[model samples]
Target: MTDSITISVDAMGGDHAPRAVIHGADLALRERKNIRFIFHGRKEQIDPLLDEFPKLKPASTVRHCEAVIAMDEKPSQALRKGKNVSSMWMAIQAVKDGEADVAISGGNTGALMAMATFCLRPMEGISRPGIAAIWPTLRSDIIVLDMGATIGADARQLVDYAILGSALARSLFDAESPTVGLLNVGTEEVKGLDYIKEAGKILQQASGAGFTYHGFVEGDDIGKGTVDVVVTEGFVGNIALKTAEGTARQVASYLRTALKANWVSMLGAFFASSALNALRRKMDPRTVNGGVFMGLNGIVIKSHGGTDEVGYKSALGLAYEMARSRLIDKIGDTMQRFPVNTAPPELPSDSEAKSA
Candidate 1:
């Protein structure tokens, strides 16, 4: 933690590339002077932006990369065209090369995941790496994993995610034994798919090995922050994330409409502006921006491509906290305490299934 943390950034990956990314880094540096940046992107586009932030320019080292991965590109196509050359690829490469403590990108999700896996590879004993996101809940923030990194995990893979996520909870929340839960159809033992129930059974048996298993949690439990970490396969987790985001937006829209409906409502809103502002900040998805691609040898943060500089800055802050916490090492240590071999019968490895 004493040493400066180096963050490798894909400067040209986001919708507001170079500008948003560079500004975000600068803002992050203002708060945490111990950070250094290695920006990968077109020299022409990035250099001028860096020049605008004198402080950031001094702390940053830019590596010019001509190619950029389009936001809409397919994972396979992005890999074929961008591997070894794209800004996104180069940023992640910095982590693998030990030049950066972590890599951050506001790029294509699938491409970012693919490049990270192809370049950094999975950590030892991990079958598939998953993306973990910080979710703001009614009570407190919780960690949710498989944020669409790899879809459809087996029971053992789900257990792996629980360990990976609890490690993150430990790093971020400083919880000695973070509560972990399986996201399922219902709270009952036999309520979910066979694999989910199986995963729950293993977690119940292994409670206190590293984390406290909180049994099964339904979708409502997520917003309630019923557990410190919620474990699920990518497919369900991704849908849940999108749904929550959409609901937040919908609620905000409803509030705005109600406030503008009449003079009385508008006056009430003005009277409660401070409280409303606090609520807005709490509900903002941008405030919790980065998705940590866990189960990898190195840390990789994926930011929302359409986010502004403030949102990107939030992502950078997440990267800094994760690096400071030694998240990857924590995951490794937690995995040892909670072995997957002791779990239910294993399914074919994700890679083998993909290849077939």
Candidate 2:
């Protein structure tokens, strides 16, 4: 394992702001002796919270900055205007300067993704840096990419996403030959868009790549863990992620209500308490709090904005795991061996570049 990994956190990023963020940092520092923290936010705002817990003061340090970028701000505008903003620039600068091994944030997703791309750039052949979120399944874990990073993707880009997703599964999950599946409306070859069908062929014929191409997987099959990695454009991937989350919440609610419906049912709950608790543990989102921004030069993790101390602590734990796994370097090496076909679109003339 790597010694003493340092993480720079955006103290003002989450829904709970400095309080939950600080608490999580303090908890992480206490639990992991080899980890250190750099809190990026205003000292005046964060110092009062630190004073409440004296023990953490000795181990962690803060880099004071005055401003913060709002969650609703546009990505390009925020990065261009908020140069001195604590949440946006400070965390990126820390990674760029090698002051921190990884930078974790729960800030505006758009702003965070844009700034990371602009500052760190992508691994040599990667067209776009994607966000990979691990989805829990009955059989094993499934890694999904481009959850919200890039919007529309061509056939070549989808193929590139599959390669990137495969590399992530190998490094993070230790799958010897990770299975790759393209997300589609149906499992058949003659389904969805032309891009999906064309991309499927490329993935199937691709040689020297370590991935096991499993063809197409439907949305319903995602929770079954039928494959190791699922590739899709950001639009479909984001909807899949949200739908899974919503469904989980609904199922948990129904289970709780059913268990408490009557005296006889309540008694049964006691007998099955261990099994019930285990099921809850497996389904809880808090257990896996951070989603990794893959294909970047350095590790950048984004935690849920609604996270509490426990969720935030899990994010820190993930950051440590990625660093020790040397995930970024592994992806870079893999890309070098089997380069992605699609390159990022070139910038057009100044007049043709405005958003539609």
Highest lDDT model number: 1
* Candidate 1 lDDT tens digits, 171-282: 9999999999999988877687999987787787778867999999999999999999999999999999999889889989999999999999999999999999999887
Tell me how candidate 1 scores on lDDT: 0.90
Residue 339, candidate 2: how far off, in angstroms? 5.5
RMSD per candidate (Å) reads: 4.8, 6.1
TM-score of 1: 0.95
TM-score of 2: 0.91
Candidate 2: C-alpha lDDT = 0.82
Against the unseen true structure, what C-alpha lDDT does each candidate score? 0.90, 0.82
Q: Each candidate's TM vs. the true structure? A: 0.95, 0.91
Top-TM-score candidate index: 1
